[model samples]
Target: MIASRKQWRCKVNSCRHTFSVTSGTIFANHKLPIQTYLYAIALFVNAVKGISALQMARDLNIEYKSAYVLLHKIRKALLEQREFTTFSGEVDIDGTYIHPAPRKANKKIDRIDYRLKENQNPEKRCILVAREHYTAEEKAKNPLYRGAKSTQVVTFGETQSTVKHFADKFVERGTRINTDESHAYDVLYAILRFMHGKSQGRIP
Candidate 1:
């Protein structure tokens, strides 16, 4: 049997199924054209904070349900294709607390803000960041050096166990690590087999 423009036909007697360009892929079994699917993918990838399904539907002129399914499939495919890499060389680690969005209240009550007060919110979210510092020569040659070097971000409390866990998981042994004078990082010396450097000031 001859294969059509968009489908392939199997020559074997046992398997004569026909499939399109999107066969066995996330875009399969969709009514939209391949170009529309590709355009949606481009929008999804380029969105830094990510786009909602409703926005995607409006942009692609498709139904909300279709957009939702399309976005989910795209995310699943991307997650399946992702790879993890360990960081080496000089790495800077630090943690910062992020305050939750303040609840909206009446004008008079809203004026009494306590967000700036120290220790006002003990359950604030913590963000742990580990960034690889590049040498001068490496920075010059690196194409993605327009901003900071590659960084790994995790959400966890600032504790000795958390710091040590991040180091063991993402950092390679013998790699130099720099951090501020926080007691939480003390566990790194015992657990992570790396050269540790403490700074009195904040890590750049």
Candidate 2:
């Protein structure tokens, strides 16, 4: 039986089912042409500052809804294909809050205190990111090795609990972790001490 590149059948006698190259994957049942998908990916990757759905639509000459869905599909595929690995050597961590602010009340007396955490916008979410730097050996071996070797991002509420959890799960013990002055990372102090003691055989 001849196997076509786009569509093929199983060689087995009992399981001669037919399938295509994009079967059982994120690109399955794609509406856009293969070249368009490739071009979209190129635009997405080349966008250092990031590209919006509207921007992608204009660049790719596609509808706004199509561009938005395609962009989200790419993001979902990346998250689904993640290879979980702990960061070692040196790791940098930071967080930032992002959300569209809600409209205020018409009168001054109706305004609420936005500064207080309790009254702050509930839609706001903090985006936490951790990047692992390449080891000395890696830098020496690879001539074009950039600073960050790998990056992990978390959108689940950023706080002391979340930061600690991320470090414990993603970071390797005895590795140096760098973070900003945000209190969210303050938990790392105790975590570092525990790891250091455990490595030195001081902690049971």
Candidate 3:
């Protein structure tokens, strides 16, 4: 530890790496004082309707551009570090293709069946969306959580692997997942079951 700079240095003879407590944190390479970041956080949290860059600039006495950039950085850090709470209650899942539609050939003889697996585009992808609804009873208990409690977006299509991964990561045991009769959802039933055997109505 370098007491003068309050930084740590690694020494391996051939390799030397220097870092500080905030080296990889949001405060990394920060020009403003550490207390300023805490004060900014306080302002951000207390803003009921949400604070604007101009407002933040006036409150923090920083440039509008600086406040804007800082606000976005804080938002990005929150998204990256936020702990995801799995959905509960009635859940609806659906997916749609996100790639270019198949194009027909110019000539009749040149035409090919694009519906075939071999003719499908390799760049094709699917965007999946899932939402968990809040019951009226639950909403009455807490009006703040009305409508959909949680929404999850899947970058890939509905498949065995994707279904299993989604269930294991973003869903709790015994939560009814409403999905179409796609073969992909078949795996979800097995995911929440005990080691001995599969449970009935695990996901319907």
Indicate which candidate wins on lDDT: 2
How far out, in Å, is residue 120 in model 2? 3.1
Comparing candidate 2 with candidate 3, which one achieves the higher TM-score?
2
Candidate order by decreasing TM-score: 2, 1, 3
Candidate 2 off by > 4 Å: 1-6, 10-16, 100-111, 117-119, 143-147, 190-204
Off by over 4 Å in 1: 1-5, 92-131, 143-163, 178-186, 189-204
TM-score of candidate 1 against the unseen true structure: 0.63
TM-score of each: 0.63, 0.77, 0.46
Q: How much does candidate 3 score in TM-score?
A: 0.46
Residue pairs with backbone atoms closer than 3 Å in model 3 (clashes): none
lDDT agreement with native, every candidate: 0.75, 0.76, 0.73
Tell me the deviation in Å of residue 36 in model 2: 0.3
Q: Write candidate 2's Cα lDDT for 80-149 as tens digits.
A: 8876788887777777777735678899999887878788777887777778877778889876877565
RMSD of 1: 6.6
What is the RMSD, in Å, between candidate 3 and the native fold over all Cα?
10.6
Best by TM-score: 2
Off by over 4 Å in 3: 1-83, 105-108, 139-147, 190-204
